[model samples]
Target: MLTHTPEMPHALQQLLDREAAITTLALPRRSFLKLAGATAGTGLVLGAFPPPAGAQAAAAGLKPTQQPSAFVQIATNGDVTVTINRLEFGQGVQTGLPMILAEELDADWSLVRSRNGSSDPAYLDPLFGLHMTGGSNSIKNSYTQYRELGARARAMLLSAAAQRWNVDVATLRTRAGEVIAADGRKLGYGALAEAAMALPVPEQVRLKDPKDFRLIGRPTTRLDARAKSSGRQDFGIDTRLPGQLTAVVAHPPVFGARLRSLDDSAARAIKGVKAVLRIPGDLGGEGVAVVADGYWPARQGREALKLDWDASSVEKVDSEKLLTQYRELANQPGARAFDADMAPLATAPRQIEAEFIFPYLAHAPMEPLNCTVRLGKDRAELWVGTQCPGLDAAAAAGVLGLKPEQVTMQVQMAGGGFGRRFVGSSDYVVEACHIAKAARAAGLDAPIRTLWSREDDIKGGYYRPMHLHRARIGFDERGNVLAWDHVLVGQSITTGTVFGQFMVKNGIDGTATEGLRDPYPVPMRLTVHHPKVNVPVLWWRSVGSTHTAYVMETLLDEIARATKQDPVAYRLRLIGDKHPRHRAALQLAVDKSGYGKKQLTAGRAWGVAVHESFSTVVAYVVEASVKDGQPVLNRVTAGVHCNLAINPRSIEAQVQGAALMGLSMCLPGAAITLKDGVVEQSNFGDFAVPRITDMPQIAVHIVPSAEPPTGMGEPGLPPLAPAFANAIARLTGKPLRELPFKLA
Candidate 1:
């Protein structure tokens, strides 16, 4: 027995009092295109087709009030607005998606504008049937979808013009947002847009050949570059509402710790302090929130409060003890990821056993987490920079006791995410909803903005899990691996979350063993141990490949050195002819880097490594030197094969940015450690990130191809650290088995 309404479901309405006065804001629509009737007796709205079966099933329990459009809008002024289904977040999806649609639309690049889409059904990832922007799948998944959308829109526009002129549609062709007749008459898309909306959408539209592309594959500048550079961009942190109040919370030192007692007398005395309330935290804890007119007052009021916490029930994890436990676990057999014969290990002429350690890392985006919630009696609205708006919207509905359709998520621009904003737990959003509910209970009827400071953000839990890898490899003089036994000890990132159903199989997490064996035809026995730790962990950048690539590439380089062979030649022999992309990428980097022809400048040495991740291959050739007992990366050249380059400039920027982050992993004090269940580092003072002075000169070259595009975001990151470390190993003659490269 379920009560259903156009607005919401009955199960959610039970939590709300029907008699309560609804407080709805008269805010202007900020979600997407608005369909307003024009004077010309033409339908302004483009009707959408019925949802696909997958999308319908995903939205069965809770139907969305509005369906997502197919991402094309031709306004009366001839301005073509393209809506991106993913967050911009400094990645060029804002520009790249538009380039894709505009290419097929034959729209002039100068007249194209892009907007960030909200948590709508139309914006879900076509393959996953989920609203998300991760795994570098933005362009990879939406490339064809957007192109088809543009082609459809173009077809309708031409059809509209043909009907108006009483000519066959074949006689009308589009060029730069204009429908032209074979006899030289032309009509701008704007004049045909309203009329085009009445025609039925074509079942299929012909796409342009790769050779006819004017925008795709071009090295175009980002559309948001001017706004971001001139400080005109409004990130999530910059969100403001008419009656919004700033909020700051005092969380317990240990995660999931409850508040025992609180004294808020001093906090109430602070000027502009509105309300102080205790609210439930994300990880089954209770925290105090201070609400005020400004951030400083809220922060000041929070600092003035005195509270006692009870952390006895939670595990007090120590980084040192955790590593010790992992080391012990690595020594024993664990869940099998890959099984290979171990009998060949004893007969091998040479063997190498090495153990590698990687510490936890924080995503630490420039803009800390901030979510603004305005709750009414029947509906609510949220403004935030989210990677998964639909997921966050559902989580908000659950927290606010409202139906999913009653919530509106206005996606904002983000400084950076690096896999931080897309949490399965939806911890940050839930926390904000809790604070807002508490504020309403305490008689503060206004939007609440829960903000995180730099310290709070760094200390906040979801981190890249710490891992320990132990490998036993047996190889011959010719650099052929006989047998390799490897074990990885770490917590499974997807163990208890929704992703665990498909991502964790056969008692092993695929993320932990993604780059173990491939492209080299290695007979390896790989095992993994996933310990249940108290620390919250999530994906960081390239996920497991962040460390697995380092291990595989560096070890292969070691084998090449042991055999007295050129690293590139050894890699080619191991890769064989099956992986031409790898071979071409490696050879391109080598030739461009002048590896064999150029003489080293005194103490510098050349390093080479190549690896594939996310269906894209990236190879690096680096020059490094040791100065004052520290490794210094001087210059690097990258060869990339991501199929087709949507925007070469975007690819170049992504590679340079990812490479710098990879280099940051090699610097001292870059690791995040915990002692007694408390994060050791607070801000950049302790946690090291690369600065301008630390960046190396990097040149990116892409392999030309007409094939469909693959991911470029993460593939550039995997090979960078290993290539730099191999060069350092050459100078020191010692294998570096740990991150932040310790030399004694």
Candidate 2:
């Protein structure tokens, strides 16, 4: 509704309405296959398997009619196929997104399959005006649009079948992939697909009511579960083409640092090594590409190569000094996001001050970053799991001096993205393009494929910037915070990058300070965003909430302690009518947790926190204890309000995973600094992620609402840290300020 087209012709409107009636054949199709040796197809089919008969439309009302991408195709067979426009990195989005549409289209669930979409403007992100997936916006952003597309498709298909059968459209109804007449005559959707396509699309389409929903809002296994589990699913790294050569780049040790010299003579001596080209940067830092017959050979050649780095000055940075400097800078002047006009200090009788820290974290996606590029004179084709396909296309073309249209970005399954894949810098892809370009210059006969090893991925850090946070809260005897001031100092996540301006306002990056101040009934609120200029940073899994939730939620617990009130009651007092979902999630967590109840042990305690992001509201209650010097979190209960659900089971899975991730961030996962500004933590061995054994027993409750569901991926991340921090404070009888909430 925020950005909708005002009007369209009735003819066009009708075409939009008849979308669901098309039935697709389950033919193997690559929507965006590179045209190196193979011809490109005319995009994917638009076959939809609508929700079961009588399933209600998603409660979150959708636009009356709209044109979605041509990615959906219905063939002459009864198959319903969807071309997924977003990248899938083990988040189950490949299945989750289509289910939302199928639920409204009343598509037969059994006849559904999905394909990854291509880099085309037709399936662009409405917010950023491009086709890509990141920012946990997949569900929330596509919810209404995709549902309406399904409804429209259904209306069109039914109308076409009615026309063929010489029956009134009103008298004909669609069931599964068939059109059934009141007289008992029936035609399968596949038989009427072409006719439906020829008919005019409907502008106004009817949606199902929630009560009639048969397949949506239910916990069904992933549609791609079998393919993925059986190892038949092809990820970006699995791509292989005829005459493709593997390449590895030795990038600069530092981002801005350049290569001083390179000696790849030994690397060139490797039997399979095709070429050792000075790619203009360091292999690990940026300039040279080592090309060989395959991945193993390319890696071996890279290992044999040597280069001199001009990292003398940049190497001055040590992790300990960086952290100390961040703390010092936290107290300095910075950009202010929110400011409160507070009276003199005499206005408040009580004051409290606290400091916090969030260390640099890595994405460490299982698949790492890899891309296959075939650069030709007229066109360039890339197969990878990139979040910004348009940008990826542009960047790839930029290196090859080609137009954006000249680049074909073939989308593939990402092992995981978490924002790392979304950024414009295709470190691996860019290197591959350079290598291919250099190869073409040398008249090589093949394209280049680039791969990043786990070690290289870890050492080549694009981390969630470490942060130093400090807060001072003043309250009256009643414990209502009269004045609040907070400062967050951290490396600019977007300083010299593409999203820098949008990210930094007057010097503050919102990603650096989300949920920084509580949106409560407080009298005064002030927060500062101090940009730590020198260090490098990037968006991590949860973005800013990774740190903001830790600070705000923990402080709220502090406020509750000082006020002698139950944490749940305290939060309820401040949470008003801003968003019904927030209230519902908070209250549900409190109720389900049975706040104030006696627990199993005298030293153990429970803590509560709530955060809303990407339109979803979540509340978490954590019960934990300290044992053997490490924090042992025993149980966690969360309440989520996603409004209308596509799949409850998937939502639960996301929430459960996010909860564990949050817990891991709280203690186990810390990218410590060693000598020479090097990260001490390299792999899972050094950098700890929560194992299945460390997982807390979690019970998730979903609050059903009639609204369109938002994203469930990262909303569950914000509350777990603070809940544990507060619980630790109770056991130790000390205000726990630092992260990893280590016991003394």
Candidate 3:
């Protein structure tokens, strides 16, 4: 179990205190009529009604209210609104979660609607107790919670129908949002919603078995597809207000640099420029905000400003120098992740010494970071696409010197996050708040929307840490491992943050060591060195598994090839029978891809790899052929074991999306490098991302299981590059160690 620090930052402590106070509010029991009307509109409107007086006192001795109406609402028009507790940043949770609830509620699929929930205590993640939407845990964590909510809602509806008909509740059954009595009488859920709201909430309700499920494992289209495709969807960057001013900041060229002198004469003279105010930035840096009527004017004004930066005190990091330092550190032992006797290494007949390098990567979601903050005398509202709304709200409150309760966070849809939006530092959110505060102080009294340009976002810090891995392995002629000594050097992502207190142990950040030694047991001595680098690092899509999987899977494949064994057969032998999921996923991919039976086209070879991340297993069978000195992925067949697919279409989409992102790692210019503490890449022109031409023909297959579902968002990504690399190695007859695949 992960424990929060006993002494938290002032902002975080205040947020927790606010959550505690919310848990103590005694909610009055309401009649069905009141509850129905309350949720009949867009969705359940939170904070619209006040708690009863002395409610806190009552809540001290009693359990807080568990109202089904808080999550489900039935309109008179037969529309069923389900509030999703996670941010819908292209993961399809808006549709996937609603499918789970509607499956149990027996609601009409066409009439079912979903909405993003705000930062309310009722929407806290059941497992983490925080309002977060990462780790691909949206479906896994909330599966049971949403199911129970639906069951309870259905039970209440049945009770109401039975009472209205003056019959026993057991004599009626629900189907498509209607209660059908045994005597041929039926009532739509809408007609009895008010009555249902008046009924006492059931403590327990029966859930449908997997065999009886109509939606859980079905392939359903995303509910937001039409809106998003038609350009009708409103993301955080699209937020607008009556008098909102678009703001863009002129940050220092280097991270944590301070502003020494500013000449804003030309900037203030620009048309539509509202205010130019200097504000504090992330990591003790200072920046100047340019507020104008629109983004164009704000950007124009920002470009006109002249400023000198003072970076004399900060460390200036060079990517090449950092890698050299990391390699040196990897040669020496530091923190011990695993310990085993290396006596066999000295006398072993065969040995392989290998070194791998991975460069820093930026998240670079489609939509850049933006936050719209509206400040009032004592109240503030923020519109942003944040994975952790509770923390963002609290950070906003702290920035504005207000109580947590005074801040309202309207969670907005995001184009994509890929772990960028959920930083422990909350840098972007806090930066927006700071700009809003400074704008208000400068007499620009309207909502301030701080936007990040594609350049700004690409150059912005918080990247995946660059890593260097050195491994010395001793094995027999038959490829039986005798000893393995490995060393990893990288900056710890959690070292000085809130998560570090729990995730870092004895100087080892657990995230850095994940997916290192698993499935295949090996006598390994592993040491890690975490250097405090100047570059800011955060979790990429799959966190450490992104690199760890590549190392493990590719190295195992190498060992198999060294012993003249089939990679698939070798993996199956090593996996043995202990890990059935890994075996099953790999076998399925192999079978579906016709790995052993089908002959590939000339110059194309088969590659296979499997990895588990976020509790889900993903295996890839790829066809690769080098063209013009570049690896081209012809096709990818994926075998996924997420336990049970809530929506097969969503699963397929996630796999396809993740696979493409993985392929991006193999393209040139994918890495984020630095020269003199300044990021070298600023936009897509330099920082390469996979385009349409780079995408391969991907086919996704899910393993059949009635067990609860796991996450599919990130597991599909970790194995893609490694599998592609394995195929390329077969072609070139040389192992590829670095990212972007240097063929030479």
How should the candidates be ordered by TM-score, best one leading? 3, 1, 2
Candidate 2 has a TM-score of 0.88
Tens digits of per-residue lDDT for model 1, 1-744: 000001112222211222111212111111122243333554243422333333322113222211113466666667787888898897899999999989988998998988887776667676665677888889998888888778867887888899999999897888998999989999988888768766655656689999999999878889999999999999998989999999998988888999888999999999999999898897788889999999999999999999989999999889999999999988887899889998999999999999999999998989999999999888999999999887888888888988887888999999998999999889999999999988998898999899999988889989999999999999998988999999999999988877776678898998888878788898899989999998999999989988999999999999989989999999999999999999988988888889989998999988888988888999999999999988999999988898999999999999998999899889999989989988899999999999898899888888888899998877888889999999988988888889978987
**Candidate 3: tens digits of C-alpha lDDT, residues 1-744:** 000002122234433554543242323335222333344345342232344464332112222223454567777666788888899999999999899989999998988888888887768776666778988899998998888878878988888888888899888988887889999888887778767765677776789998999878878889999999999999999999999899999888889999889999999999999999899988889989999999999999999999999999999999999888887887775989899999999998888888889999999999999999999999999999999988888778888998887888899999998999998778999999999998888878999999999999989889989998888999888888899999989999988876787779899998888888788888999999999988999999999988899988888888888888999999998889999999989988898889989889999998999999989999999999999999999999998888988888888899999999999998999999999999999999999999999889888888898999899888989999999999999899888899978998
Answer with 2 or 3, whichever has the higher TM-score: 3
Query: What's the candidate order when arranged by decreasing lDDT?
Result: 3, 1, 2
**Candidate 3 clashes between residue pairs 3 or more apart in a chain or in different chains:** 32-194, 32-197, 32-198
Model 2 worst lDDT window (10 residues): 1-10
Give the top-scoring candidate (TM-score): 3
| lDDT per model vs. reference | 0.84, 0.71, 0.85
Encode model 2's per-residue lDDT on 1-744: one tens digit a residue.
Answer: 000001111222222222112212221112111111221343234333333444332221322114432545665556677667688887777888788777776778787778786665545554444555766777877776677777877877788878787778899877787788999888876677666655544556777887887777778889878887898978998889998888877766555466778898899998899998877542234567888899888888988988887866555457677777777776666666777766634467878888887777778888878888887669888998887776777667778888767788888888876777866465566777877888888878786778888876776666787778887788866667777777777777765565664666677666777666556756544455554433455787778888888888888788788778888877877786766677888877777776676455765788788987666778988888888877788888788887877788788788888888888787755554545655566688887788888898888888877677677788889888888888888777677777666677
Of 1 and 2, the candidate ranking higher by lDDT: 1
Q: Cα-based RMSD of the predictions, in order?
A: 7.5, 7.7, 4.4
